[model samples]
Target: MSATPADRIQLTGLRAQGRHGVYDFERARGQEFVVDAVLELDLTPAARTDDVADTVHYGELAERLVAVVAGEPVDLIETLADRLLAVCLADPRVDVATVTVHKPEAPVPHTFSDVAVTMTRRRAR
Candidate 1:
């Protein structure tokens, strides 16, 4: 059997304040955006060698993700998710990236727990 997507690094609840919405008030004041990402990569090399270089550095990855979220102003969470996917895929070793962007403060008529967008991308061969 082939390796499953279970081989991955997961990061959750990554919060960053950003201006990402269609509403003018949202862009002006900004709101908290949460991120959850799963970086798919083989862990065998790192496990065998016991070396940091053999695997993805999650700390740096988190920082890079934060930069993307807090940097530019996008109109939709889908686009934000795409930008985040790019960041994960930037590491050649990452075979796939599954990301979710959550907006808890979305303007809605009714009470809602959250609004989010999730996407999964595979590296091009």
Candidate 2:
């Protein structure tokens, strides 16, 4: 028999406050960071079994991201975005991952809006 198909799951707009920046002021006074993640995985087994183990648990995923962001100080959002992608791809169930990190209180000379870095990665077939 042919295998069933998988489904796409997305976790969006997970907000967290972290101190990550190249400037001392930014590091001293932490700022809000926004994360949006999209996880593509095979949900057939999980759906049939109705078990959390069979699928990617969003709680764990969010926790992992939190751990990474709060782990240490980083100079660039790009690095943070890269690390998050690595963490997501570590899960075997994940086929594709897109991570976006937003820095709202950036140290810009003039008044401006949020700055963010977004990247997409996929597991090797």
Candidate 3:
């Protein structure tokens, strides 16, 4: 059987400051953006070889993801999430990648928890 989404590596709660929003104030005063990502890939190679080379190095992945959050300014978290998914799927081993971008400081008139965008992408065969 092929690797399914169930077989995954999850990275969560990565925080970064980014200027992303529709309003000018939001862009001027950057807010924290939290990210969560799930990568689906076959772990058997790594397991069998016990080699880091066979698997995704999460430290490297984290750095890349954080760079995206801090690199460019976008109007929507959805676009940010899409960019993250692109990063996640850059590896040939990864079959699917799911990313969520959280904006805790979203401008809202009422009390709320958070606003976020989630996106998933699958590699082509």
- Per-residue lDDT tens digits for candidate 1, residues 9-116, read 999999999998999999999999999999888888888999999889999999999999998899999999999999999998888899999999998889999999
In angstroms, the error of model 3 at 54 is 0.7
Candidate 1: residue 76 lDDT (0-100): 91
Q: Count the backbone clashes (under 3 Å) in each candidate.
A: 0, 0, 0
Off by over 4 Å in 2: 1-6
Tell me how many residue pairs clash in candidate 1: 0
Q: What is the C-alpha RMSD of each candidate to the true structure, in Å?
A: 1.6, 2.7, 1.2
**Candidate 1: deviation at residue 125, Å?**
0.6
lDDT of 3 by residue, 29-94 (tens): 898999999999999898899999998998899999999988888888898899899899999899
- Candidates sorted by TM-score, descending order? 1, 3, 2
Question: Against the unseen true structure, what C-alpha lDDT does each candidate score?
Answer: 0.92, 0.85, 0.90
Return the clash pairs for model 3, or none. none
Q: Which stretches of candidate 1 lie over 4 Å from their true place?
A: 1-3
Question: Candidate 2 at residue 64, lDDT?
Answer: 93
